[model samples]
Target: MGLKSWFSKLFAKRVVQKMYDDAAMAVQHQEQILSYLVDKGVKTEFGRDHHFHAIKSHTDFTQKIPVRDYEGLRNYFDRVVKGETSVLWPGQPVYLSKTSGTTSGAKYIPITKESIPEHISAARNALLSYINNTGNAAFVDGKMIFLQGSPVLDNSKAIPTGRLSGIVAHHVPGYLQKNRMPSFEVNCIEDWETKVDAIVEETLKEDMRLISGIPAWVQMYFEKLIEKTGKKTVAEIFPNFSLLVYGGVNFEPYAARFRELIGKEMPTVELFPASEGFFAFQDRQDDTGLLLNTNAGMYYEFVPQEELDKPHPKTLSLSEVELNVNYALVISSNAGLWRYNIGDLVKFTSLSPFKIRVTGRIKHYTSAFGEHVIAEEVEGALSETLKKDVAAVTEFTLAPQITPESGLPYHEWFIEFNREPKDWNVFIENLDTALQNKNPYYRDLIEGKVLSPLKITLVEKDGFQEFMKKRGKLGGQNKIPRLANDRKIADELKAWSVKTIASSNF
Candidate 1:
């Protein structure tokens, strides 16, 4: 590494040390933090702002701010999405991280200079943490590949976004070799496409070491790389490859399938990330859950699932949150969000209060046909019903699709599994039974109110998400709806996943 790059790494390490040793305790406490924010109210800079206290009263602080849905933030976000300057701070937004809203069409969230730096440290920590925790410098002698969205925009302008990813790429402390391939996408800027194409094309021509990004997309690239080079395995192609880094979603369901392709227990790191903030990350492949990125930025809050929809339900500041119960996440951050709902549901894995295991999205649900099918309920039912049949949820996208034969709607579960049962019929029946038992709505659906039954789709172990990523329909904050709850959303899922999954008789 160059001298400048080496010192950047050295400096970054010191910063990381300060974060863990100095700021750790303060960040962990939520009550004392309220005092801190109150004290620093309006005085705290953009990076230091709790944001909640910026416009709120001291009385509102303790009363537990009411959680907002789409309607709540519409006016505010609409101003930004309409291309107004100062929507974030002053100037027009530089990049819009396009993503599907929970109950609406895709959204374009804005970011500005002041709020953009929060991700730099996260990007830097990603590198430092890997070295400190894993004690490996595989990149010191090899190339690093980051597979991501359309690197180029439609106008040919560089998408000055990624919120965190852009900062990571442009500000990496001691980046070894920045090698990659053209973003695998269509209909945008020619130059941007060219740049992405250059990266992808060249990566195909050589070896890659530390690799990261949406696992589904990366796997797709590897598939193409194989087709181009006629190589059988990634190890044979990128001999220097050491560790695989993935996040944006759960890796368990795809674990068996990915292992078969990447070749068994290939060291990995599962990351937890969202546009609102980076909560935590996995430091080791074998670790059950990711180490909370409590050090990254912002303070956190959690309210019970039952309380999420309650008017002014009780909210727990970091210190007040309890363990094991599923809670809706709330954030107090530099981004000016105070008690903002990020739409994720999580359960704490420990008493320390710094760790959590993401269960699923709060809105990814179905109650139409009397079955209130939610991510948690479906996850629970699938696990219980398939207890001995299979062990992993690896990856799943549940939706209501029309069956050609039955000429009726049904709840479809697209499953990618390593082993298939000899009697798949009983397994499917039991899965349906489990869902009906967990939620009363499902029973009604079975009784003919819902108009559908359980349909199982066997996928090519590692498919699905790749199809979405190729279409710029994948990311950390994105949710794959469980019910195809509405028309546009349902049609979109049917477009990408339907074509890839195997046909079902049900």
Candidate 2:
């Protein structure tokens, strides 16, 4: 190791030690954060409206505030967007992270001066923890590429606005600026396809070691690299590439394809970051669950998945949660979100250290026949099936086929495969069996004859990519929905398939 690598290792050691110390006291840190937030919140307009002055304990907080999604909190957010001071947080926000929403067009999540540092530090600590665990700091010296959105900010709003990734880009520490790749000019090209081409041009021959992005987009970049250089594998193109950092979606669905693309096993770090807050990260190479950011400037609450739609659902604190139960994650952070429902469902893997694995979105599941199947279950089923079969999938999604042309209603799976399974019948059988084992409701429905066995529709190569492109959500933190309650997306895919078939015939 060089002098810089040596220094990084030393710094990582201290950071990792502190992280362990903090995680060991997860409940205490969360309590402290809650107190601090309430203390500051009492002065804000929202706090006053919610009678924060009289709040004393977590119970009092629950009585005073109701869990709310983005639409529920939009009234306060609108005031903040109009440049109102002390509307939500103590004062005007430093920036607003603009994210796409379903019912709401665009959500502007505040990032206050106090909270922005948490995002930066948590990401830095994730890396430091990896270095401490693996004793691999050599990647720090090589060119690092983060596939993300345009770093350019939109100042038309009261506060500067951009994607969360774009906002964090501006805060890249001065030391790493020299090592970060894809020049600012290339990063600013609003068009993702164009920007990727530019990135391919710039980093085709660089010593890339650390690559970070949403896994699907990173896969697209790898495909482009292979196409340009005729390289059989990404490992062949960048022999120095050592680490991959990914988030926004579960990595298991893409793991097999990634292994095929890289041609070797590589260390990966999974993060749980959102516009609301940076919540968790993989702290150990051997661990599947991400260590929750308990000591950060945020207090957490978990609502049992069954109680989410209730008018007054029960909320559990960090110390009160049970293991392996799906819970809708709620948070009150320094960014001024109070009892905010971020729409993510997570299951605790370890309660002692507060580690969790994201399961799915609260609203992003297929319950068409009353058998609720979530993203985690579907991903798990596919992953389990691949273990026994020689198959690699590019992308996949599930929806209910309520009215088929010639059969009973069943779940329809649209799959784009990198390499088709050697035995299609056996692959489908194994996948269905795994899913049934994971979700008992689905199993009951199948056994009762309410629904037939799931059917798979093979998508042409790049079909999903073209679908995303047509929807104008080609890249930068956008992800395909793993399961849908309705057929809006399924219908669109059907139309795309028709168009693709027609074009091919022509």
List model 1 lDDT by residue over 1-506, tens digit each.
54533554565567657655633574444445445544433442321322544435434664544456445656656665565544333445456555566566655445444445656555556566666665565454566666554343333333344433543344344344243322334212233334334555767655577777765556555556666677777777777788787776555445655655665467777677666667776544445555555543365677888887677777776655677788888875545445568888887765442667777787777654545577767767776665546534345667666444545677777765546655666677777878888777678767864465677766554445554455555543333454444444444444434332222434
List the candidates' TM-scores in order.
Answer: 0.74, 0.97
- lDDT of every model, 2 decimals: 0.57, 0.91
Q: Please write out the lDDT profile of model 2 over residues 1-506, one tens digit for every residue.
A: 76777899999999899999999999999999999999999999999999999999989999999999999999999999999999989989999999989768889999999999999999999999999999999999899999998889999988999999999999999989999988999999999999999999999989999999999999999999999999899999999999999999989878999998999999999999999999999999999899999988999999999998789999999999999999999999999999999999999999878899999998899998888899999999999999898899999899898987775778888888899888777887788889999999999988988887888887878889899999899999899989898888888887545211111110
In terms of lDDT, the best-performing candidate is 2
Q: Please report how far candidate 1 places residue 303 from its true position, in Å.
A: 2.0
Model 1 segments more than 4 A misplaced: 1-19, 22-59, 62-65, 80-96, 110-114, 150-168, 174-200, 284-286, 295-297, 369-372, 376-395, 400-410, 415-423, 426-453, 457-479, 482-506
